[model samples]
Target: MELSPVLLYGEAEGMVRSLQSFPLRDTGSGGWLKQHEYIEKLNMQAILNASAGQEEMIKDLLVTHGKVSSLIRELITVEIWKQKVFPVISQLQDFQPRSTFPLYMVIHHEATIINLLETILYHKDVCESAEDLVLDLIDYCHRKLTLLLSRCSAGEIAGQDRLLPSSASETSSLEELKLQAESLEFDVALKCLSVLRYITDHTDSLPLSITTRLLNTHNLPCVLVELLHSCPWSRRSKGQLQKFESGRWLSVPAEDQQKMTKLDGQVWISLYNLLLRPECQQKYNIDGFTRALISSHRDPHRSAAEPSGATAISQLFVSERTGAPKEGADLRAGSRSLGLHYQREFWEMEGDSEAPGEACVLPQ
Candidate 1:
């Protein structure tokens, strides 16, 4: 009987090369996000092939999507766990506290490379078993995102070009993830608690390197804060110097790193808890949400969620620079913003009456 070649006999590589080498044409209009995602899927397939003891195959994969940073990160992260890593992870967790932070961060980052590994585990594309590996990948993203947010404040990733946005939908998703993380009833990781809080409070005050990398992800110029820092300070204009401009990492002086860490991560936890509670649901009305947030400290005065009074900016954080004073005076003008913001908008519109009444979801 004919058997498969011990090595590749033009079965996988030769068959797939044509699809791999074709230059993509400009497809107008429809969000090519799907196209890119498909490309990523193919790229991931190449990576899986490379893992099957084929360096040349991996090289081919790299050549196709070398410039895609996300793809590269996912690829590297997934590829790092050929052997058992759980014991190594536990070792890092138990090591010296200061070093443990960075070490675990590394492990988590590597493990979380493939965000959709869970969904793709059952996919028939890869010939080998990937269940154990895919679960590990999801575990890594959760671990890293949680640890980095908990241990390092926005200060670390905030200033970085590749910095993740503090308000990213993923932060909200993390709150939901907590339910799943705890579904097993294992002791929920304290790091998870800290990171959730930080995300909710919008605390991006991490180390300069981390923050810079995180910010860099948003395509903001890396030197933005630096340029602000280098702005000349004058005797006459002394008050204009600000936190970021002045290179102050934290928006305001904090009691301690631990306190800031807890506060920053708790916002989402609280939001999630409130959202899941029946008490919040009873009063949840679309039109009143903005106002309810503004007057959150008090109970609703009416059936509506927000109090019957005019709204306040719930937490709009802005540094205000005022007029200069005398020497040793408060001349360094600046305002430091932190936490959630409060905004109120009132609008009057005149338009064609085809659609007459605007829908307003009033609190019951």
Candidate 2:
């Protein structure tokens, strides 16, 4: 006998309910393998239901089952497993597996939950449901963002689509897994930014422990300042500006170059919430390093409004940050005066001819 639609929904809901109380401790390799599949299925169904505008059932299933904390634990568990277990498995001489696809799925598991959380965490209930484990989620996001920044700063990170190379024979090895992690790093960092912003939105109701972890412990405001300094989502490639969008880096035209992308907006909005929120202000330490770093990097002049001569001159002032005047002072008036003075001299000497091509570098 065929089940009615209501029965099917109930059956599906029951499965999730059973999975909710799923044991997290001492789940052996076999158990973890099974757990991986279950999480993947839940994530896939969640996405499909979300797209079909039937998110209520999935939301209730996730919250009622208390799956958020489980997801957090599982995410950290996988990360730890990757760090501790995968390397030893890679070295075992007789451990050839039939397929590396399972291993790949294990690595991709973190991304799946990240995607699901991004979809559902917008609701206040979901955020509240996370409870104290929200601190774990915050730490997880911090690690990813910090890793992204360090890689970028060290000049080790590639463009969004650039993957770590792997030969066919090396597909299932730890080396290949490392490569996959590198490839997923950019997307993961972007998702983390969104998740952090959502958490920031609900900070007023967050537990004191979560607030302490986010503000004092993590110094997320300072971390965000670093992101603004080194924007991971956009970069210069052979003089062309490429922005990460729809999974790959696409060339951005000159007109839209100055526009802030979603990644930038996410960081800035999170910063606004963290630094400006009354509760956050009391918790965060806004010391000299934070103040100077923020003041030094923020460009004051309009990108479009300024003349090329003025723009080039402004960079000199920015680069001279130490000796540069304080943040609120009117450097614009002085810089424009200096720019006009130089423009007149160049015009008088060259008779309105264009300056040398290497005269000034455009902002990337």
Candidate 3:
């Protein structure tokens, strides 16, 4: 039976109240399994509502309960699990399972929550509701983007051309499962890109710490310039260009080859947001390296009417090159060190807690 709006809201409320972190070892425990199932169903419903232009009660409920922080905490927790625990499990000689589906689901939990957040966080209120946890979410995005850049730089991301396996039966060996997990990681990183863009959208109203993190601590503008160069989402195979879209890659026709994909727009818009905002401009210290990076992408032929097009970016680059440094000038190197101190203090408060003692078993 289809879940009614009332039932969905009830489920959302229950999920909010029950939200808590699970240790890496207890990822597939009964309670965590139940929450995972709930998230999957809610994610579908949220997408459906978004497509149909209906009310987003799930977003409303989450905001009402002020559980956005809890949701972000869960996202970070599962990400930690994927990074720390999944590898050990993959290598365990005696850890054979009846199926790898449960393990895959645990690894997939990060993607699910991020997708749901992407759906709901389009609203300004939802962004506001994230409160202090927004800092944690920024840290998470930094980690994902940094890893993505390294993979792209080493050409590791493009080498994994295979799509995720269709079923658990196809992932028979642990090594096969490991490959699938790596593929999923690429998708998760792309999703993080969209999430980071949304966070940038709200920087005007967000705390100053957000702008500081994006500009000084993370130096995301430079990172984004590198992404534009790598173009990880678009790659060549057999001399045919393919672009990732709607969860799978499709070959680009010759006519559409020059067109910007959604990923391209995301990166450009994020740059626009970070560079054009007055507060961001004040905080962002554009040295010679950043100026050259931005100038390298300048296009004099781009239409000025286009939103966040090459023209706007080029103008910004020229201004930075000629404009005097802002008052209270401090080197980014100092800001980075200060930002690290703040990051360490923030995470130390999160504390490491263990799961309740129980046998590790597949969720059923």
Tell me, by lDDT, which candidate is best.
Answer: 3
Give the residue spans of candidate 1 off by over 4 A. Answer: 1-135, 162-364
Q: Rate the local accuracy (lDDT) of all candidates.
A: 0.28, 0.66, 0.71
Tens digit of per-residue lDDT, candidate 3, span 1-364: 4344534667666866676667656778998999898888778878877655678877887888787787898899898888788887777889988778888888788889999898887677888999888888888988987898898878685536554456545656676767777887888888888888888878888999988988899888888877887878888888998999877789999987766566766776677667765677778877777767765664212344432233344354445446635411322223333323322332233221322111111111
Query: Which of the predicted structures, 1 or 3, would earn the higher lDDT when compared with the native?
Result: 3
The runs of at least 3 residues in candidate 3 whose Cα sits more than 4 Å from the true structure, single-residue gaps closed, are 1-7, 159-172, 298-364
Candidate 3 residue-wise lDDT at 168: 44
Candidate 1, 1-364: lDDT as tens digits? 3432333524434433332211122121133333333444444554454334334443343234332233333443333431244335444543434333333333333223232232122122220222223223224434444443342333332221121355334544333322323221111222223322222122122223322222232211111122112221111113331222111223333232112122222322233222222233223332344334433433122235533221221221100112224321321111011111110011111112322123211111
Which residue window of length 10 is worst by lDDT in model 1?
335-344
275 Cα displacement, candidate 1 (Å):
8.2
lDDT score for candidate 3 against the true structure? 0.71
Tens digit of per-residue lDDT, candidate 2, span 1-364: 4222322457557656655323434444566666666666666666566555564567678788787777777777766766677777878888877767777776687777787787778667888998988988999999989988888899875544544354636465555666776676568778888899889878877887878899889888778878877887878889998988756888999987876565665665566566545577567665666656554545222354544322333333343344565531454444444444433443343333445222321111
Model 1 has an lDDT value of: 0.28
10 residues in a row with least lDDT, candidate 2? 355-364
Candidate 2: where are CA atoms >4 Å away?
A: 1-8, 20-31, 48-55, 93-95, 159-174, 299-364
Instruction: Pick the TM-score winner.
Output: 3
